[model samples]
Target: MSEDHQPETGEDETVIESYVAGCPIDPELAGQIVRLADLPWNDRDVTDSAMRGLGWSDDEVPTDEARFVTAAGHVVYGDYCLYLPFAHSYDVGGELWPDDFWGSLPGWSSQRGAGREEFEAHVDASIDRFAERLGPPECDVRTEGRHLAIGRYSWRYAAWRRGGNILVIGPALDGFSYAQDEEAVVYIGEFAKDSPFPDAADFLNLMHT
Candidate 1:
C-alpha cells in the first residue's frame, strides 16, 4: 500500500504493525491473498500449511474477502494486506539518546478523518488556521504535501521537532508520535496531552480513539 494508506479494523483489535520505514510489501498483496484464499480447498491449489506460511492461521482462512481480511491480524488497506513479519526495513543509523524511545512516543493513537480526502481536508484546514494564528509558518505545508507520504511525520515546537508531534497517517494503521528529542522519535505519554499547537493535536485526536 502507499504510505498514506490507513489501517483497517481487525478482530483482535491489535493494529498490525506495518508501514514502518524499511518494511515494505506489495500493495496488491491483499488482493492476491484474497484470491488465494478464494480458491476452492482442493489439493492442487494452496494447502493449509501454505496459507499458514502466508501468516494466516487455520481459522484465518477467508470465507469473505472483506470481512476476513479486515479481521485478520494483518494490516488491511483498500485491496492490500501486509504480513508484518515478512516486512523488511533498512534503518538509517541515528542515535536517539538519553530518552526511552517508547516512552517519548504516544501510547496507542488513531487517525482523525475517515479516509484520505476527509483526513486531508481536516489537516489542511487545521494547519492553515493554525498558520493564520501563528502568523506565517516557518515552512508552509498548506497543501497535503509529500511529507506525509512516509506514513509518519515529526514536528517540534512551532516547527516539526521538540515539543511537537509525529503522525502516522497510514490508512491501514494510524498512530502518533509526541516528539523527538535528539535521535529517538518520542512516543506519547502524559507529557503533552494538552497541546500548544493550536488545534493540531486536538484535530488529529478526532481520527484516533
Candidate 2:
C-alpha cells in the first residue's frame, strides 16, 4: 500500500515527516511534545497498566519517563518520538503529579532525597542511553531548582543534538499520584534551523508511514 493510502486513526497518531538528511525538527512540533510530556498521569501503577493495555513490549516501557524509541510504527509528534505502553492520567480524570501527593513519598520531605537524586541521575543516564540507541548529538541537562518536580512529581530535563538538530526528553509534571502511583512519563521533541518538512506533502508523507 502506498503511504498516502493508509487508514487514518484520527487519534493524533499520525507521523509528520520522514528521516531526512540534515533537516531539522519544527519548533511547533517540539512545543507540542513538550506539552505532552508535561501531561500528568494519575499514578505510576496506572501508567504501567495502561502500557500493558496498549500492547507495548516490556523493554519499551521504563520505570521513568527518560526513554526514546526509533522504530517505524512508533508514535511521532513533530521531531518528538513516543514509545508505546505509556500511561496518561488525563484519560482517567486524574491530574498528573499533583503537588499535595509529593509529601507522601518517603524521603521526599524537603523535595530532596537519595531517591530524588537517584531519579535525576537515572534521567541523565537515560539521555546518554537514548543517544547511543538513536544517534549522537550535543547533550545538555537543565534543572529549575534543587528538586526535580514535574507537577506533583519531580523530574529533570535532558536535551541533546543529533546532526544539526536538537531533541529534548523528560518526564511529565504531575505524572505521579498515590492512588494510581505512576512511575514516569517519557517525552521527545526536536529543534532545528528549519522545518523538517519541506512542504505539505512532506508532512503527509510522514503520516503515510
Candidate 3:
C-alpha cells in the first residue's frame, strides 16, 4: 500500500512521544527542514520550486553535508525515491536500502546486489547514530510480526524531532510489476494543521501494529 494519501484514524489511540528532551538546534534551520519535508513527495521539481519559493536552496539539503552516498551506487538525496521505487517501504520499521537502487550515476556505480541481512542490520543501527545528532528518539521500537499487504514482516525504527518535523529511521520495501526489493530509508514529516491525526502514535495506528 502506498502512503501517498493522508489517512484519518477511526478513534482515539495512543500516540508515540519521546519523553527525553530533544537537543536544540538553530530555530531557522529546523524551520527549513520542516518546510522542505512538508512539500509534496510526488515530484522533485515541484517540491524544489516550492522549497525555493519558501527560501530553500538545494544546497541546504543534507545529502552532501551528511555524505549520504554509498560506494554501492545508492544515494540518499531528496527525490531519489522517485527514480528508485521500493516495494516494502514502511512495511517494517526500516527497509533494505535495497540493491534495486543501484545504478550508474555520473561518477558512481553500484554492485546491484547487497546482502539483505547485512543491510537490514545497518538500518537498525541508525537509531544510535541519529541519537548522536538529534539527542534521543521520541519513539523507537521493533514492530515484528506486523501484517502487511504481503504477509507478516518485522522491522525496527526510531523517531526524532527536529523542531516541528518528525524524523524517522525505518526500513523500506516495495513491489511492482516485475519484482520486489527493500531499501534503506528515513522519513521527515509532520501532520498538517488540519490533519486528522495529531502525533506519531495516532498516525502510526494506521499501520495497525
Candidate 4:
C-alpha cells in the first residue's frame, strides 16, 4: 500500500548524516527533531522538504500509525515518521491534545522497527548521545491512562525542554494499545498555549494526530 509518490533522494540521507556528526538524541537527533516537531499541520511545503531532506518517503504507504515514514523501506534504521499538518483544513492549535479529537496537536514520532536487541541498542545510543548533545532531561513525561493514547501515544518518557520545544524520548507511544509490546521512541513537540478556539496555529492538528 505504498503511496503513488516516490521518495525524494539521498538528500535526506545526507541530512541525517550531517545531524549524526555523531550524536544520537533524547535530543540525540536534536536538530532534526526540533525542526520537524515545530512544523505544524498546515506546513506542507516545509514538511515535504524537511521529510525528503531527512530521507523520509511516501513510498511506504501510510499506516494507522504513520502518515509517512522517514526511511521508507530501510530495514536496520527501524520505522520512523515525521508527521506534518494537513494542507487544507481549519484546525488551529486548541482544545488540548488526545482528549480533544479536533485539537491541533501533531505526533512527531519514531519507533524502532527492528528486533528487541537492536531497539534496545538504538535507545541506548540515543540516551548516550543526548547526554552529550543536550545534557540530562528536564523531567519524566507519563501517560495517566488510556485517555492520553491518541494517535501514537507515549506512556512514559524523559523530557527535555529546549525553549518552546519539548524533546521526549524513551518508552511508550502505544501507551495503551492491545499491541503494546513495541517500546522505545522519540517525540518532539511544541508547548501548547491557551489560545481561543480556531486559532490559525492549529494547523488541522486533529486529523493528523
- The per-prediction CA RMSD against the true structure, in angstroms, equals 19.1, 19.1, 15.4, 15.6
In candidate 2, what are the lDDT values of residues 1-209, reduced to their tens digit? Answer: 22332323452333221110011123333333333433223244544443444443345422445332222222222223342212122112124322222222222221211243444443555555555545543434333432322243433444543333334444343323333222222333233445442222232122212
Q: By how many angstroms RMSD does model 4 differ from the true structure?
A: 15.6
TM-score of each: 0.20, 0.31, 0.43, 0.43
lDDT of 1 by residue, 1-209 (tens): 23233333332333222212211223343334333433333342343344545564434432233212222333222122112211111111123222122211222122222333433333344334434433444433221322443345432222221232222212212222322111111011112324543343442332232
Query: In candidate 4, where is summed lDDT lowest over 10 consecutive residues?
Result: 14-23
Local distance difference test, candidate 3: 0.40
Error of 4 at 65 (Å): 4.2
Tens-digit per-residue lDDT, 1-209, candidate 3:
11212122542223211111011123343344445554555556765565456443444332452223322223334442212111122211113221212221322222212243544555655555656555777676665445544456666666654443456665554323132344545555543343333233342332211
lDDT of 4 by residue, 40-110 (tens): 52456766677678776665443444545543232112123332221111111122211112111222222
Q: Tell me how far candidate 1 lies from the true structure as C-alpha RMSD in angstroms.
A: 19.1
Instruction: Give the local distance difference test score of model 4.
Output: 0.38
Model 3, TM vs. native: 0.43
**Who is ahead in TM-score, 1 or 3?**
3
* Best first by lDDT, ranked: 3, 4, 2, 1
Q: Which candidate model has the greater lDDT, 1 or 2?
A: 2
